[model samples]
Structures are given as C-alpha cells and as structure tokens.
Target: MTINRHCPTCRSRQDFRKLNDDEKAWVRAEGSRSYVDNLWRCTAVGCLTYFRIGRINDRGLLPEKFKKEPPADAERP
Candidate 1:
C-alpha cells in the first residue's frame, strides 16, 4: 500500500509504504488500519506533514503484523 500525500510546507509529495493491517486502539475488526514501512519524507526539508502510503486491499485476507527477530540468547537453546 502506498500513501501519497502532498505536503503544504514543501509542496512535495510524501510517500509511505504500508505493510499490513494490524489491530489497534480506536479501531475494530471491521475498522481499517494500516502499517507503514520505509517511510519517506520530503527532501526539500521544512515539511512536517507525514503521509503514510496506504492502499486498501480488496482481498479477503487481513493485514498481518511484522514479526521481530528472535533474541540471540534464545537461539542458543
């Protein structure tokens, strides 16, 4: 998912890459949520507006959360 938004400060485009839909507060199962990665900011500088790249997935599958790497100590076992 790509969230494209125009920054009024920089007049540049701020893009955000959406990863998946994860559960969150103020949002229900039927509600919409987006996870963004590789967030990009205006190179022009001065634009504080942050835009997340998000595209609605028409598929039936819901967005899954990103898994963090296991601890190195745990791997020793």
Candidate 2:
C-alpha cells in the first residue's frame, strides 16, 4: 500500500511506496544504501524519484568502522 510522504522533486506531499525487487537491485547497482534502507519512491505521475526515511546513514548511531566516506573525487553540492 502507498503512504503519504514528501517528494522533494514535487515539492509537496505525495503518495509513495516501497521499492520493488527490480528497483532495489538497481539501487544496489548504484552503490546506494537505500537498497536495504527504509526507502520509498514517489508515485505521482512523471515523478518516480526516491527518498529515504531510515537511519541507514545516521553516523551518530553507528560505529566508526561502519561509517562511509565519499570518494575523494566526488563533487559536493
């Protein structure tokens, strides 16, 4: 079932659902933690963007050894 969640691209609350297996695999291929995270995708027409509501990257709650660092050449916004 879909739930109401904020869609960053839509800039509004929208319907969202859990990622399917194919979607999860794709996310995993992209090296995203969201594949195993409490991730959701906007279901609004033409807006299938993804977002996460989990603590997968909450460093404060994680051990130092598990913390991840972006690649040196990765650009920061």
Candidate 3:
C-alpha cells in the first residue's frame, strides 16, 4: 500500500489537529495539558477518517480493544 502523509480521503493537504485536554487530564498524572496532540486523516480515498497517533494500537497495548469484535455466528449473506 502506498502510504502518503497527506490526507488521501479528503484529498486535502490540510489535516486538523486534536487535543483531548478534558479526557487527557483524567487519563494519568504524566499526561497533563502539555500532552496536546495532532490527528491525521485517513489515507484512503473518500474515507474521510481522522485519527490520532494514540488511536492506532495495532499491538493491542490498549486496555481494551478500540475496535468492535466480529460476531462468532456471523454468516455470509
């Protein structure tokens, strides 16, 4: 997959930043107001998905999986 730092979904070079100050304060002591961060738009065309660096946990280090689990009985329609 060709990875582009730019926003492929919006096709816009401008991707907005994010700062969850309210949530961050409640996260931990080390995570203070200075922990403000920037988020990136999805690299998929027309997807328009924006996410933060902390949001990506491919290693499953998160306390709980951010993604929903597939149903065991899911069947092909």
Candidate 4:
C-alpha cells in the first residue's frame, strides 16, 4: 500500500517516494523517541515538492502530520 498526503505546494493528494537509508537515518538522528521523520517527495504532475511525515508505533507513516497551513507571506504554487 502507498502512503499518500496532500502536497504543501500544490494542495493535491500525492503518493510519496520513500527516502533512502541515509536520509532516514538523518531524520531519526534529528528527532527524539521513535518519532523518526521520513522525507517524501510529491508525486503529482508538475508538483514535485518535499515534505516530512512522522512514523507511528512502528506501523507506518501518518499522512495527517504532513499537512501544513501555508505561511501567510508565502506564495501559492
């Protein structure tokens, strides 16, 4: 099964490509507990952006954590 989340840039639901071992290790090192942040790239057409999702209970990454409110000063994609 694929884990999909909304793209922060495009606001479209997109499947993500899993990060490599090095990237996963880096994220794990940066966080506490077992809350390893996994990096994912937006797979929607023309909306290739990167975002992070947190792993939960060793089950899987939760997509809800990936949603972010756009900064008021930021431009929409």
Reference-based TM-score of each model: 0.24, 0.60, 0.25, 0.40
Top TM-score hit: 2
- Residue 50 local lDDT, model 3: 43
Model 3: how far residue 53 lies from native, Å = 1.0
| Model 4, runs deviating above 4 Å | 20-37, 54-77
**lDDT of each residue in 1-77, candidate 1, tens digit only:** 55566545445666533333342221334454343333333323223232332422222222233323455786794
Model 1: lDDT equals 0.36
lDDT per residue, candidate 2, 3-44, as tens digits? 886666678988877767766666676664633456676666
Per-residue accuracy of model 3 over 1-77 as CA lDDT, tens digit each: 22344443345554333324543343344343243334333433234344454454311111121222455676446
Return the clash pairs for model 2, or none.
none
Residue 40 Cα positional deviation in candidate 4, in Å, after optimal superposition: 0.7
Residue 38 lDDT (model 1): 33
Which parts of model 1 have CA positions greater than 4 angstroms off?
A: 1-5, 12-34, 54-77
Q: Model 1 compared with the native: what TM-score?
A: 0.24
Clashing residue pairs in candidate 4 are none
- After TM-score superposition, the amount by which residue 48's alpha carbon in candidate 2 deviates from its true location, in angstroms, is 2.6
RMSD of 3: 10.0
